[model samples]
Target: MTDIADLPFAMYDAFTDVPYSGSQAAIVLNAGQLSTENRMRIARQIGVPATSFVDRIEGTTVSLQFFSTVMELPMCGHGTLCLITRLVDLDLLPCDSDDWHNATLDLPKGKATVKYRRNTNGRIEVMLDVATATFAPAALDMDRLATLLGITPDDYSSSLPAEVASADFIHLCLPLRDLDAMNRLQPDFAGLAAFCIENGLETVAAFSTDVIAVDRHLHVRDFCPAVGVSESAAAGTTNAALAAYLFRNNLVKPEGADLFEIRAEQGLKLGRPSQITSRIMVSDGDITRLQVGGIATRVIEGKLSLPSPDSGPLSQQ
Candidate 1:
């Protein structure tokens, strides 16, 4: 067994009741000595879409950083949610007591407060208060995007034009006309990499309404070669951006309620079948607040050894 002192961390994948179904990442709670290079190296070694490192802070807040396999990002929803859940699990916070209801996370972009609550079924659910979304028009290179995705221009939905939106990082939203077209999408990762590099896009969110039940709506499928995520099972920030897209385009009529709730179904094609619930408040056509919540299941817990910074690549370890 590896020495506990050398391990220095525990990791978990949230929102997946089944093992290997949802996204996974490492969690470094006491990230005092770890440098950015080390973090990225570990994240790349783990091979998950995003990993989180936490530094305890004063009050109910904790400092956090998110890293993908190749780079560090401003913020990540799933990684943030997983870190908070792990905190509660480790007894780092009073998860079983009343004090567990709220905790704040200090991310690179800003402060993101998380709330924990139990549903009627007695399952733990987490809610992350995220930043408001911003929308701007960008030339939709349908030919290039479709070429990279191996789809045609006719696949996109007529009601919604492809555009870039942001809650944390920028993502291009492409609404497909049907589920078949959405399913038919087989992206050329190399092509997508080149397209995103030249176009300055971080990610592409391609979705269809065919899977959406009229009673319960959903935001699905976050594919980004830029971030090295082929398909994100559940992306809260993207959901927030979708909500803003809906409200801005008058797709959903918002009355007195500032908050809008919707279900996000993802990982179906991948056979994981995950669900995410998101809520956002918009006033005067401006998003004021956003929150994404879901249940998390602990799949695996283990430790890994790393080479010292001077030891060159981790593969040697």
Candidate 2:
């Protein structure tokens, strides 16, 4: 057994350029040698929604593992962005002569493409190439759904129906009428968690076209209790799914081009106020490419003390 030591870690607020304005994720450096149990223990101790362990960096390929306080995850969108930003900030993925540097991420599900480059102000900009989103109509009762969100059925948007969208994770895509309904959301965390688990979902992505910023496309709030978070400030996968949902319903379409960009505002109610960007490329009425990206600010950098391995095995909640 390895002796207890201070494990180096960095926390970054993802999906935003300013610190403390986005979702937080912890990136544990040099965590390749840790056992799965140890990683889980560390994740629980960190108590973040998502924690990334930097396993290895070989040339242009980076191996990473993501864990929540409850269990291991196949992939994490915000976590990936934060991890990439951390790598760049540490000078591990230094900028070259080219405008952008491309890398591959070794995730538990599969390999994913990543592009990063330093902006004019030298802040690292990272974009993750996510899986093409596919959606299925959800059979949830509108009344029940309304009760779940503490809103009335009349508050739902008449434009789009509820759906289960997938792009690495599953989210119940719900549409609200306006920002007022969004501001009145009062989710039953326990009930939401139970519903998510029963439906094999990760989050309920509530979005509206009524955005505060004129340039933004949607205002979103992600409720994810099944995966251990009550509500996410900014979720990568959920926003990617939201982008596809809009495109599928013809809510947003490209008139003169095949690529349509989607900008979403999230976490405002939580006071984090994250901006998430996604692009969808269409080819002959079919989605061909999907990408989500944003900038992150490093907030806390320090070492974490590992619990004694002999104390007891921590079980997933």
lDDT of 1 by residue, 185-247 (tens): 888988887787787778788876567555546536777778778777777677767766766
List the pairs of residues colliding in candidate 2: none
For all predicted structures, in order, the TM-scores are 0.88, 0.93
Candidate 2, 37: how far from true, in Å? 1.8
Off by over 4 Å in 2: 1-3, 307-317
TM-score of 1: 0.88
Least well predicted 10-residue stretch by lDDT in candidate 1: 1-10
Q: Cα deviation in Å at residue 32, candidate 2?
A: 1.7
Report the error of model 2 at residue 36, Å: 1.6
lDDT per residue (tens digit) for residues 180-287 in model 2: 999889998998788788878888999899999998999999999998899999998899999988888888967458998899999999999999989888889998
Screening candidate 1 with a backbone cut-off below 3 angstroms (N, C-alpha, C), the clashing residue pairs are 15-296
